[model samples]
Target: MMATGGRRRSSESDELELGSSGESEEEMEDSSEDDQENEAEIQRLEEQLSISAYDYNCHVDLIKLLRQEGELEKLRSARQKMSELFPLTEELWLDWLKDEIRMAEKASDRENVYELFEKAIKDYICPEIWLEYAQYSIGGIGQQGGIEKARGIFDRALTAVGLHMTKGVAIWEAFREFENAILGTLQPSAGSILTPEQQEMVNAQLDRIHKLFKRQLGVPLLDMETTYAEYEEWADEPDEFVTQVYKKAQQQMEKRKPYEENLLAADPPKLAEYQAYIDFEVKDGDPARIQIIFERALSENCLVPDLWARLTLYLDRQLKIKDLVVSAHERAVRNCPWIVGLWKRYLLALERHQAEHKIIIETFEKALNAGFIQATDYVELWQAFLDYLRRRVNFSQDSSQELEELRSAFSRGVDYLKQDIEQRFGESGDPSCTILQNWARIEARLCKNIQKARELWDRIMTKGNATYANMWLEYYNLERAHGDPQHCRKALHRAVQCTTDYPEHVCDMLLAFERLEGSLEDWDLAVEKTETRLNRVNQQRTKAAEKEALLTKQEEEKNVQRKKGRSEKKAAKRAQKQALPGDKRKADQEEWGAQIDQPNKKPRAGELEEAEEEDMSAECGLFGRENNTRILETPALQKQKAAAAARNKVLHDNSKDDLTVFVSNLSYSIANPEERLKEVFESFGHITDIRPVYSNRGLFRGYCYVEFQEEKAAADALRLDRQELEGRPMFVSPCVDKAKNPEFKVLLLESVMIILFF
Candidate 1:
C-alpha cells in the first residue's frame, strides 16, 4: 500500500511537472488575456446581434469566438443558427467540422462527426471533405461490420466527387488504396496457401482495384496521364481495355488543352478568357468542374459584380441550392456595394428564397444607404422595395399591419423625394407623381377610402401637377368610380378651373360627365359655364390674331415700297445711258448762252438748213458724209423740230418749278448709285427717277439728278442738303439753271452782306 501511494504521488508530481514545463507564467498570462479578449469579442458580437439579428458579419464573429473558446455546445448552437439563416462557406464548414471531429471520443461522438461530414458534402461536393470522411471511416475497420461500412463510404465518396477534374484524383486514389489494403488482408500468409473462400475474396478485391484504375484512367481529370502511367506500372499485366480508355480520355484532354492554355497565358482580370472557359464547362454539364472554374475566375475578378451575378443566377436556376445561391448574392452585393441593381436583385432573390421578414427589411434599409449615382436610381430602388411590400399585403384586409406599413412607406417615400431628392438633385425625381397616384389608387380601390384618395390627389395638385388636364381627369375618374356623384361633379368643376394647358378637353369632360349624371338644373349650369368660358377664350384669341395681322401688314407694305424704289432706280439708270450726247451738249450751250445774256442768233432759212445738214453729217461719220448728198427739209420735218423745241421748253419750266434736284459730291465708286440714292431720298417723298451721271467709260461721275413726281417732294428732299452719303457731304440744289435765276444770285449777295455786318 505504501508502494502504491508512492506511485500515485510520483504520477501527480509528473503531471505538475508536465504542466509547468508546457507553459511559463508569462505564457499562461497571455493565454488568460486571450481568453478574456475572446469573451469580450463574444459579448460585443452578441450585443450587435441583439441590435440587428440580420447582421451577417456579427453572426460570423460570434461563431468564431465561441469556437475559439472551446464552448462546444454554444459553438454548435451558433453554427446551427447561422446555417439556418445563411449558407456556410467552404472554409467555415471546414473549421466547424474540424472542431467537431477533434472533440469526438466515443462511438456516438463519431456518429455525430459522420452526420457533420454528410452535411458538409451536401453543401458542396468538396473532394477534401469526402477524402477525410473516407479515411476517418477506414480507421474504424476493426469493429463489427466496419470493413463493409468503410468500403461503402469509399464507394459513396467516389460517386460523389468522381467527376471533380482538379481534386477528384485524390478520392479515386484513396478508394483504390482502401481496396488494395483489403486485398492484402485477404491474401494468405507468406508460405501458406489460401482457402477457396479467401482466394475468391482476394481475387474480388484485386478486381476492385483494377476497376478503379480503369475508371480513373477514362476520366479527363487533371494529371490523368500520370494516373494512367502509374496504373500501367502497378498492374501485373496491363489490360487492353485500360489502354483504350486512356486513349479516349487523352483525346478529350487534347480538346480541353487550349482553354487551359489560354487561362494560363492570360493576364490578371482575364474575364473574357474565363467566360469562354465557363461556357465550355457549363456545356460539359459537370457541376463540380463548373463550380471550380467559377471559383478560379472569381479569385482574379472579385470586383466584377456581373461575374458574381452570373454565377448566382446559374446557381439559383440550375443547382437551386439555397445556401450557394444566397451566398453568391451576398458576396455580389458586398463586392459592389454602390450598385443599386445588385442590391435590388439581392432583395428579389431574398424574397424568392423566402427569407425572414426582418432580414428583408434590414436589407432594404442597407440598400437605401448605398448612395446611388442618380435620383432616378433611388426612385427605382424604392419602387422595387415597395413592390415587394405590396406583394406581402392582402388587399382584403382593410386595417392590417402590412397595410398600415405600406401606407407609411408611401408617405415616407413622397416626403423623401420632395425634401431629400429634390434638395440634392435640384428637381423632383418623381416627375410623373407615380407614388402618390399609386397611393391614391390603393386607397380608392383596396381600402375603400375615398377621403384619403382625395387628400392624396390634393397633395399631388399642390406639388404643381394641377396644370395638367390628364391629372384633373384622373382625379375626376377616380371620384366617379369610387365616390358619390356630388364629388365627381365637384372634381370636374375644379378641373375646368385649374386646367390651363388643356381647358377645352376638361370642359368637354365636364359636359360629358354632366350628361351622364345630372339634373336639368345641373345641365343648364354646365352649359352656361362652358359657353361663358368658351366665349372668353375666343375673344382673347381674336385680339391676339388682330394684333398679329396688323404687324404682318406693316411689314408687307415696307417690303413693297422697297422693291418699287429699286425698280425705278434701275429704269432711270438705263434711260440715262441711252440719252444722246448731242442733247447733253445742247443743254450746256443753252445754259452758257443764258448766263452771258446774249440774244439768240437767228440765222436765215438757208443758213439754218445748211447748219442742220453739217450737224447730221458729223453724227453719221466723217468719210461717209463727204460722199452722201444732202436733202432739203420738207414741211413735216420743220413741224417736228418746232414740236421738239416746244417739249424742251416745257421740261425746262418743270425743272425750274422744283420738281427735280441736282445732287453732287457723291461717291465715284458707288455701285448701282441710282438704286442706293433712291433708298436714301425715297424716305422723303415719291421719287420718279434717279439719274446718276457717268463717264463715257461707264463709270460714275460723282453727280446725279433726282426727279420727283411732285414739286413738294423735291422741296422736302432739299431738307437733306449737306447730309453725308458714303462718307462725303452731298450737295442738293434745285435743277433750275442758275443763269436764269437772277433772284437766287441777289439772295446770295444779301446773305454775304448780312455775314459781313455781323
Candidate 2:
C-alpha cells in the first residue's frame, strides 16, 4: 500500500518497508506450520481483553496478528474496538487512516473515508492528518463546488495547525503551492494580456494568493525566513504592513528560539523541556505560543493527565473561549478517559458551556464505561453527574421532570456503587457513603421529604457505618436541621447502642443536646443511658488490656531470641573476616579491624584514671576518654591516625596544627557533617578540606578536622568555640598532637563528654 499526500507521510519505499514486516515469507511459513499455536495465542489475547478491556498491549497484539494473517475484517474490528475504548496513538491512527484511504481510492463511496478523517483529527491536533485531508480534497476539484470545498479545507487546516512552529512551515508551503497551481490554470496563453473583465478575475485571484502569504507570514513559524524570501521574490516590493508583520514575527521567533532549541536537543516525550517552554510562554503572555507548545508536548505525552490538565486549565481560566475549552476537555477525556479529574472537568466544562442535556448524559455514560483503574474514580464521576442533575432540579417547586430525573440518577448511581463497583473492586469506593449522604441531605432539606431522608440514613447506617461516631453525628445533624426533636433524640439513642469507635463522644453529644432541646426527664434519661453504656465499655476495655499484656510478654521473648541470633551471625562473620589470607589488601584488614565488633564501654571495677592516662601516650594515636582513660581501641582508627601523623610530618602546604581546627562536641547524629561544617566555617576563609571522623561501623564520632588556608582563618573560626549546634556546644580548638601539647589543653572535665584527638 502507498502512503500519499504531504511530505510528513511515509514514502512508497517506507510504506513498503513497513508492510514487509507483516508479509515476511518465513514468518508466514512458521504461522502456517504452527497454525494451532497461533490460534491459541490469539485466543489468549482475546480472553485477556474480555477480562480487562483496557489491556492496551493485548489489543495491539491482536490487531497485528490478525493483519499478519490477512484477516482484514478482524483487524478492522480490533482497531475500531480499540479506538472506541481509548484514543489511538499517532502511529496507529496514521496506519489505520492510510489503509482506509487506500480502500477509499479503489471504491467510490468516499464519505466513510471523510468521516474517518474527522474522527482521526478529533483524537489529536495533527498537522499531518490535516494536511492529508486538505490534499485528499484536491482530488475532486473538477466537481461542482469541489474547488471551494478544497479551499475551505486548506483554510481550516491552516487555522488548526498554522501556529505549530517546527513543522508548520510545511503546511504553509503546501497551501502556497496549491494556490500557485490554481494561479497557473487561470493565466492566459504565454505573454497574453486580458480584457478589463478577465483582468478583474485575475486580480482577485492574485489578491487571494497575497492574503495567504500575508497570513502565513504573520505567524512565528520555523523557517519563516524562507517564506519571507518567497514573498520577496513574488512581489518586487512587499506591502509595508506585511513587512512589519514579518519583522514582529521574527522578533517573537528570536525570543522563542532558545526554548525550541532545548526541545530539539531533548529526547522524545520532552515533558520537562516543554513544561519550561510552556512556563516561559505563559509568562510571555502569548496564548498562541502557550497552546502550541502544550500541544507539541502532549503529542508525545498524552498518557500524562497532568499535561492535559495544565492545558485545559489555561484554556478555562485565560482563554475563556467556550469551544476551545470544551474541545480541549473532550480531547483530554478521550486521550485519558481513565483519569477521573479530566472527566470531572469535562463535565463541568460542558455544563459551563450549556451543552445540551443529551450530550452531557452521553459523556457521563462513556465515563462510567471507561474502565477506570480504581473503583473510586467511578464513584467520583457519579457524584459529579449527581451534582449536575441536582442543580438542574427546581427544588422550590413541589415536583418537576428535573426533580424526577435527579432522583432517578441518584438511585442508579447508588446502585452502581453498591453493586457494580463493589463487585469489581471488592468494596464500594465511597467508604464514607458520600453519595447517599448528599441524597439524604437533598431529600430532607430541599423537598422536605423527612421520611425519604430517614430511609436514606437507614441505608447508610446498615453498610457498616453504624459503628462510626461521625456517621451518627451526620444523621443527628440532619434530623436537627429538618426533622423534629423526637427524631434527633431517637437518632442519639440508636447511635449510643451501635457506635463503636467513639461511643463516648456520641453519648456526650447526646447530653449536650438534651441540655439545649430536651426536658428534665429527657436529660435524666440521657444520663442513665450514658452511665450504663460507659460501664459496659469500660469492662470491655479492661479485658482488651489484659489480652494486650499477654501479647506484649510474648513479643518481648521473641525479640530477645532474634537479638541473640543476630549477635551470633555477626560473630561468625567477624571470625571469617579475621581468617582472610595474607594476600588480601591491607585496607581490607584495616576496614575490618580487630575489636571492630566491640563497643567502647565505660570503666568497670577498680580501673584507675591515673594508670589509664599514663598508658594513653604509650601508643601512637591512643587518645583520652571522658575520664582521661584510653578509649579508641580499634586498630583501623589507630592505623588511620598514624597515616594522619605521617601526613602532618611532611608539613604539606603548611597544613599543620595552627591552620587546623578540631571541631568536637557536636551531636553524633548530625547530618551531612562535613558539609555542615564547611557551611559554618568557610566564612572565615577558603577551606581546604573537612574530615569528619566516623566510628568503625561508619557512625559519626562527633568530631572532625577542619583545615583552612591560613592560621588567622583557624583563629577566626575559634570564635565558634562552645557555640551550640544540634543541642550540644561545639569545642573548637587547635588540632594538636596530644602527646606533644599535653599542657596546652586547658582541662579534661570528668563531668563533660570529652574527645581528645590528634
Candidate 3:
C-alpha cells in the first residue's frame, strides 16, 4: 500500500509540473508580444521627438516605454540624456533604480545599483527611496565589511529623512527588525546550556536592540505606539529611560494627530488642505517638518504648477540652497513646460544664482521651444531673452563678440515676431513696435551708429506707425539727439503731412522746430502751411455746426406741432369726462342727431369749453355768479382758482386744452426721459405727449411735462406724486403757467412747500 501511494504522488507531481511549464510558455509568448508593441511605441515617440525636440510628453512616454522593454543599455542612455535636459521625477528614478537592482545577479553587479541609488537620492529626498536603498544594501551583508556598509547606509537614510512624521516610521522599524534578526542569530540553542562566549554575544545583541528602541522611541512617528508596546514586552527589565521617551513621543504624536487625520481623510490631490497644513508646519519653523509636508503636498499635487512654483520660489528666495532651488526649478519647468512664466522665472533664478552662461542660454532656448499660448507671449519672451543678451555686452568695446551676439538676437527677434508669430496669430505681436524702438535706441545711444538707428526707425515707420504724431515726434527726437538737423527737419516734415490723428500738434511741432533752427524761408513756409491747415479745419467745423443747427430747428418745430395736436386731443377727452351725468346724456342725444344732420362735423373748441364749464357749475352747486365768487374767495379755494386760471391761460395760449402734469425731482442723468415718463404716465391713461425739459446743451433739467388724455387720468397720476424715480422722489403736479397769472404765487409757494417736504 505504501509503494502504491508513492507512485501516485509522483504521478500527480509530474502532472502539476507539466501544467506549470505550459502556463509559463504562454506567459513568455504574451510578454514577447507586449515587448514588441512597446518597442514600436518607443520608435513612434522617438520620431515625434525628432520633429519637435521639446515635446515633453513624448519624452516622458519614450522613457517609460524604454524602461518597460528592459532594454537596459538603451534605458540607461535615455535616462541619462533626459536627466541632462530635464530633472528626473521621483517615480522615474525609482523605476530606473528598481530595474537596475532586479538585473543585478552577483554581488559585484550591485556597484551600479549603488551608484544609481546615490543619483536617485540627490534628485528628491524621498523616504521610500532611502528605505529601498537600505533594504537593498542588506542583501550583501555577508560580504567583507558588508554589515558595516549596510549599517552606514541605514544611518545616512535616517539622518536624511528620519524626521519624516509619516514615512519615517517605516525606516526606523526596518532598522530595528534588522537588529532583532542579528540578535536571533547570536542566541544560543534553545533548551541548551550556553558557554561564556555565547552569553556575552547574547548580552551584546540585547543591548543593541535596547539602544535601537531607545533611539526610535525618542522621535515621534505614526504608529509608534506599536513599537513602544513591543519594546516593553521584549525588555528583560522595566527601564525608566524607555518609559520617559515613550511618554514624550506620545505627547508629540497627539499634537500632530489632527494634521495627520486631515491628510488621511482627504482624497488624492488635496492641494488646499495640504497647503494649510504646510503653512502650519512652516509656522512651527521645523525644517524637517516643513520639508516633509512640502514633499507630501507635492506627491499628491505634482501636476499643479503653481505649487511647484511656490516651492521653487521659496527655495530660491529664502533657503537659497543652490542645489535644492535649481532642482526644484528644473522639475517645475519639466512638469509644466507650456507655462512661459515658469520658464521665464527659471531663467531669472539661474541668472540670480550665477549659473554658467552656457546653461542659461540652453535654458532660454528650451523655453523658446516650449510653445506659448499667444503671439504676445512670444514677443515678451523674446524681449526677456534679448534683455539677457544685452546685459552680457560691454558697451566700451568697439566691437566685441557679446555686442555682435546682442545685435544678432535683436535682429532675429524682430524677424521671428514678424514671420513666425504673425503667421501663427494673424497679426504682429509687437503692435507697439517696442523691439525695433529698443534696437534703434541701442544703436544710437550705445553703438553710436546713427545710420543703423535711422534704418530701424524706417522699418518702424513702415509698419503702420508713420501716421502717428507720437511716432513722428519719437523719430524727430532721436534724430535731433543723434543725427544732423537735416534729418530732424525731414522727420518733422513727414510728420506734418502724414499725421492725420493729430495734425495740428504735428504742424505746431514743425513750426517750433523751424523757429529753432530753420532758415527764414523754412520759417515762412511753415507759417504758410500752418495757416492753410488751420483755415481748412475751421471751415470743416463751421459746416458741421450749421448742419447740426438745421437738424435741431426741424426737430423742435415738429415737436411743437406734435405737442399742440396731443394737447387738443387730451383736452377734448377731459372735457367729455368732466361733464355732469345729465349733461353727458344730453350731449349724447345731440351727437346722435348731429350724426344724421351733419355726419362728420365736430364741436368747436370754444363750444366744448363752454359746455364743460356749464356742467362743472351745475355739479358743484355754483350756478349763480355770486356763489361762485364767494367760493373762489376762500384762502384754500383761491389757490385752486389761481392754479386753474394759470392752466387755462397756458392752454389758450397754446390754442389747446389738456390737463398737462409736470413731473420734477427726476435724476439729471436720467436716460430716455420721454420714454421713462411715458412708462409711468401710460399706466394711468394714454399719454398724449411727454416734453422733458433740457438745457441748451441737451442735458436733462430734472423735470418734464406729461399730458394725459383725460382729467381723471391727470388726477390719478397725482397719486404718484412724491413717488421715487431713480432714487429721488418725483413731484407730479398740474402744469400751471405761473408767469401769466399773478395770483398763481400762492400755488407756486405751496408747490415749493411740497417739494421741500419730500
- The regions of model 1 sitting more than 4 angstroms off are 1-89, 121-125, 140-161, 188-207, 234-241, 258-273, 282-292, 295-305, 312-758
lDDT of every predicted structure (CA atoms): 0.76, 0.81, 0.77
Candidate 2: count the clashes. 0
Lowest lDDT sum, 10 consecutive residues, model 3, at: 1-10
Shift in Å, residue 483, candidate 1: 12
The top-ranked prediction according to TM-score is: 2
Top of the candidates by lDDT = 2
List the candidates ranked by TM-score, beginning with the highest. 2, 3, 1
Give me the overall lDDT of model 3: 0.77
Give per-residue CA lDDT, model 3, range 676-731, as digits (tens).
88877898888877776655333567787787778778877887877799888898
Candidate 2 lDDT for residue 358: 99
TM-score-superior candidate, 1 or 2:
2
* lDDT (tens digit, per residue) of candidate 1 on 568-628: 8668646644668776446435644553563344445544443444344434533454424
RMSD of model 1, in Å?
33.8
